[model samples]
Target: MEYRRRTVLRAGTAGIAAAVAGCLGSNSTDDEGSIAGEELALATTTSTYDTGLLDEINAAFQERFGAQVAANAQGTGQAIESARNGNADVILVHARSQEDEFMRNGYGVNRRDLMFNDFVIVGPSDDPAGVSDTEQATAAFEAIADVQAMFVSRGDDSGTHTKEMVIWAEASSEPGGEWYQETGDGMGDTLMIADESNAYTLADRGTFLSMQDNLDLEILLQGPIEGGPELLANPYGIMAINPEIHPNVNYQLAMAYIGFVTSPEGQDVIGNYTSNGQQLFFPEALSDDPNFQQYVPDGWQPNSNGE
Candidate 1:
């Protein structure tokens, strides 16, 4: 929870260059010192950690490997920064562009596809903006802006926040008005704020499912459209901090985590874990099962009274 409290400093021109330099210069064992025990450092987005999926998987991982994992859950941007600063041994996050850049810069290695979920637009059940009927996510966002519907954004450069920005760009809308608000918080807290204020917000399906019973928002848009619009399709990836880049990193344990999450047993656990009778995440790295392929982003069919 302390990870939630740390503010992400503005990554300005000088800050970014310095962060990169730090990553490059800190690879020496003398700089990072040595680990004292069999431990792993995991830095990741709040979505996965907040949904309780990581805790389940981590328990199994601990049981099998006999290693203590210190999970530092934060926004994807901050998690990447933590890796750049040599604070995390491995990372499991969903923001694709950032993840790609992290690897390109030589901070991480052995990136593996772990699982896939989708983002959804959720709002008051009355559908004030009529976003529920929009065929595309962009259209829904446009409508919300057009009607000046209250909207809450994570505003923390999180994975969900990144996806929301992408949708806004696709809609060609720059959403800033009295109706728009930023929580600068995680998914669960953002959802609660949206619920209390009757505002529209984008969320990953896993967190939405996990906290659905406690909120009043309804899913308005989901992914895997009739065509292949990929904005809503959220896929997670796992990677170890390049041990060569930071010698204190537990590369073997990081690899074990990568192996376990992509392994058959790990995949089984992912495929079976559900929230409110719906699967939270689907194992995608090595799975070709039809059951995992079946899903509706809307959370439910239309014209159903909360069935």
Candidate 2:
């Protein structure tokens, strides 16, 4: 695949970073030695950044490869487009359908299952919409819409935004007028705004948990394991941009990143990462184990094809 070369480069850098000084090497390099100026560019989602996962990954990657990883954290839609336009060498996103389309079009290759976290509906503790403890996301959304409750949406075409749209569609509600508000910002910012406005919003559990101390809102609903619906499963994946379609892309570096992130060592970091003493990402490799899958929803699948 055209993305193979860039993938190799990314993987090699990550390997080097891991072998050297671990995560400390990331801050030691200048922009010229970073992935942005060298062999790779990573485009990812805001959720990863808000949860502090990307920083950890970047530090380790830089230490192993001695190369800086220039990462643009945006909505999944924009991230995929970045790769399509040769603006990025790799992508880490949670939108499966969009990722599939990108791969089907030859924009990227060698997509691998990286990590996963579930989505949660957050709102005031008073439960204005009476959506707390709801098992069906669609029904919860319906109640929120019917009441015209204050709702804040990322509205940035991000993976979380896309999932919210799906739930709204399933609930047959259109967000408009005063009932809905759109904030084309990252997850952390959106949560802050939501808290200030006392509105409801859909967010990744990791981000919500990490930002919990700064906000007063509570989780209204969680995934099936947490009594939420099965449709709330959120899986994250990584893919390298296809060099054949965009000759300037660094295929080798992108692939190296893919290998490192999906490797056992990388998975261990992901699984062990915590905020407020709660694990943020659940490793797919251990998902089948009784302990690991205990909190995961049934019928959930790890996305590996990037599609």
Candidate 3:
């Protein structure tokens, strides 16, 4: 699959400052020959950034390590594309199947588990499709399709869209009608579109929680809530772009980033981060906690070691 070029949304000014360190003569290089205060590019899913978790993590990482992180927020597919094109040193995304393919194609290395949340079906409170009664994601999708209710799709090749396609396939539906709409935008934007249109859409729990107060939609189906199916569990992972494939990549900084996010300190940050008094992500890296393990998919491994 050829990935088209797309603009990578930089995290903030702190990241951009690092990018111009050379011109500014900041002397950011360390004695150990590391670019301690140099810029590092990270391509990641929109949900992670839209929920404001990525910005929080980026702030901590820059402050603690004296390094600047330029995070490009996009869908998982586009994020991977950025990494593949050498536009990013590392990537953090939730599309496991796509990540597997990226690693297999030698575009990524040191792939490791990060954190997790779940996807939910959200629609207007009126429940026009009556999807609230469905037991699983597929059934809810079927109900929406059967009723010809307004359904908004991310339609941006995002992880959420990929999962929606799987559910639609399981329901034996192609999802085309005047009631179904596509918005080629991020999670937050898509949710707004759904809200304004009173349409049902699939969304990650974190993003939905972050924007719920502003949205007219309600959670119609949640994977963990109503004993929903396993497909709704959304696991996230991080990886450094392979320097071997693209020698111009900042492999050293990328490895450092991968190390930090998987470390105990990083996990704590993710686990403790909250919005509206609700926790958004649960850290599971190198953890044996059964509760976290339940969300991990079968045959899933932290790395090639299967740990």
Candidate 4:
């Protein structure tokens, strides 16, 4: 679906001061009630920030509410931890199991499905493991392992890293050793490492598309779309930090942000975000299929065995 892409302001040192000045209005003084005081903190995954999605959303949110958003972009694990520690008011993350655990543990509330894209294994264009033709992710991983092909891993406990571990477990008893190298960095950096080393690495499709022009790696295995347990469906969700746990958190502001994101307007924006003219997130909650969530909770499911 096509929607207007919001203009992103360059919020460097000068732009930030100007934005703050604009947000504070004419009555605000230099010493009293600065724009920073009115800002809401949003802790989110790096993929969202690196792709420039958060900047667009933050600009819109600030314009609509006169309340700026201070975003901390990190791995999903770190984002969740920030929310838990009351360092952030809300969280946008991709790891469903971890998100559920956060809610169940009373660290967050109002967990809602947001948006999604699938993971893809990227490797050298020559396809040393011969995974370019394989439909099964396990088979592809096994082939890579059999040849001891160099593989790069985020190894940072990010959502992508978690999915990679699951795929490796399905393919073999172990996924770490000499052939598997861990970078402990975000998606963009990991992709660069993979490209420079001519190794394979799992990455979110959004990040892959955003960085495609700068990288030499090619998509080897896309997440399964069918086949039962073997499919790796990556879903993203938003959760508000429990106000009861963090009394200092901006609860109402956080809810407003959630409402904006899940609303039809916000979902429309998410559905339309694209890089290189290709849409990044697919909205699945509006689908008529009852098992849509079961298959692709956010938007995509792994393509297991080419099914």
Candidate 5:
């Protein structure tokens, strides 16, 4: 899959000065050379890039560490594949199952619970298939499937695609035929396709809200953020590519980037990022004890108390 890359270049002097002044409160100007002239390759989901959160946070990070960042936007599956192939130094994504698999395969390390949002079922404003009346996400999906209402799917094996498949499994409905359309694309493009087709689809709340103004879609069913089902909770994680597997990876820079994002400063930027007065991603790593279980595979320890 041809993934689009967005490089977070060093901001202008005024922007860098502003970040150095406050965004990174205690970092002195002398500390800029700590990772000076380094470029960290980041593999992440479209939601982060689409929502423009990286642009805000990377400005501060570049000023503080003097390292440029190239954030590649694509599906979670593609992101992981990039990391596994040693094309990216670090990855930030929301697919827990895939993350667990990557760790189990010894392709990544230093996995940190980074942030979260939720998924919402969106559709045409007229509410075809009566999706608006449904209480659960699965129920809404079932209704759409029942009526064979045109349902657009992010069929590119993304995190959103994984969640959509799960919901379909729970509803015991095989989504296919003329009613089910697969757009093997990222969240932003898939949404545009859905909107143009008058179709219902599952989307991350952040990306949806970021582009809501130009869309005809409405949130017919809420996710965890709106007091909906736990299944829709979209927790994201950041992990560094294990140097042992691929010596070419910038493991040191990756870990540094990880620390900054999970730090209080990083969490603050994430928590404060908003679209049209609505908070997008919530911070998940500020704590007395950091999450160590992210290092282990899922279900390896039944009492691990993780995620």
Candidate 6:
């Protein structure tokens, strides 16, 4: 089968962010895998969907497997919930902590570390809370709390929201009062809320870059790429819902989707995805070797037989 790669919005510094829904891959005969599993439901994060990464990757995936992907963009936590309820055949999300929990709860299996991108703190250019001066994310959060600076939170238990809470914990400050706010929305929407109110908010680098032109906020502090702390690193994972728990899901298609995304072809599509002349996600599924850690939760003790 011939792979017809779809194009993503690659603007200069100004990003023209829009999701790609065009048909990917050539219109040819359906393969056996495609015929066996024609529909694939994916529950994933808003960052992946809003940034249009899925559309680009799905193009290559369809080209190879011929499965039509229908992604339901939601918070990482909500996405997991959807999988647990048998609504999603597979999931792609960031928030490793949540991913670990999902695996622990026996709702997911065949976990694979897919790709990663770092997070950054974006806020008013004036640096009202002095977050611009902080090198570490924890200090930046403490600064925002000290000054009672306006801060908008996703508060939707999304990957971004989880990372924000972890930073607050490290900062040793309980964010409250009129300063901290919750939008209960996704990354793109929360970023807009912060921009609209001139507030401080933690955002994944890709989403912020894609929506930067429409935002007055500036990237005050960066993630690991800019010598920032490792705390801001955002790693995404792909997992097929456990069929033992829900036999109705298209497990075969789910695994095929996983294989395509983690394969050399999938990794290329992910690595090649860019917005505003910057790469959005760095592929990690194909490391030096097959990482079996994906099969277990983080810090799980390995037995002789491999639990």
Tens digit of per-residue lDDT, candidate 6, span 175-226: 8999999999989999999999999999999999989989999999999977
At residue 41, candidate 1 shows an lDDT of 79
Clashes of each: 1, 32, 0, 8, 0, 0
Which candidate has the highest lDDT of all? 5
Q: What TM-score, to 2 decimals, does candidate 6 have? A: 0.87
Model 1 Cα lDDT, one tens digit per residue, 59-167 = 8766655566789888898899988887787899998788877886899887877888888889999999998788788999999999899999999988888889889
lDDT of 6: 0.81
Backbone collision tally, model 1: 1
Q: How accurate is candidate 3 locally (lDDT)?
A: 0.79
**In candidate 4, which residue pairs clash?**
223-302, 223-303, 224-301, 224-302, 224-303, 224-304, 225-302, 225-303
Q: Taking the tens digit of each residue's C-alpha lDDT, what string does model 2 give over 1-307?
A: 1222233332345443433332232334442143433445789998898899899987776666656687888888888877787788789999887887787687877676678889999999998899974678998898888899999999998899989889888887777888799999989999999999999999899999999998999998887547678888898878777767876666656665776676666777788899999998887633453333222232345689853
Where does candidate 3 have its weakest 10-residue lDDT segment? 1-10
What TM-score would every model get versus the actual structure? 0.81, 0.81, 0.84, 0.79, 0.88, 0.87
lDDT values of the candidates?
A: 0.78, 0.77, 0.79, 0.73, 0.84, 0.81
Name the lDDT value of residue 302 in candidate 3: 95
lDDT of 2: 0.77
Query: After best superposition, candidate 5 residue 192: deviation in angstroms?
Result: 0.9
Say which candidate scores most in TM-score: 5
lDDT-best of 2 and 4: 2
List where candidate 3 sits over 4 angstroms from the true fold: 1-33, 288-307
Deviation (Å) of 5 in candidate 2: 16
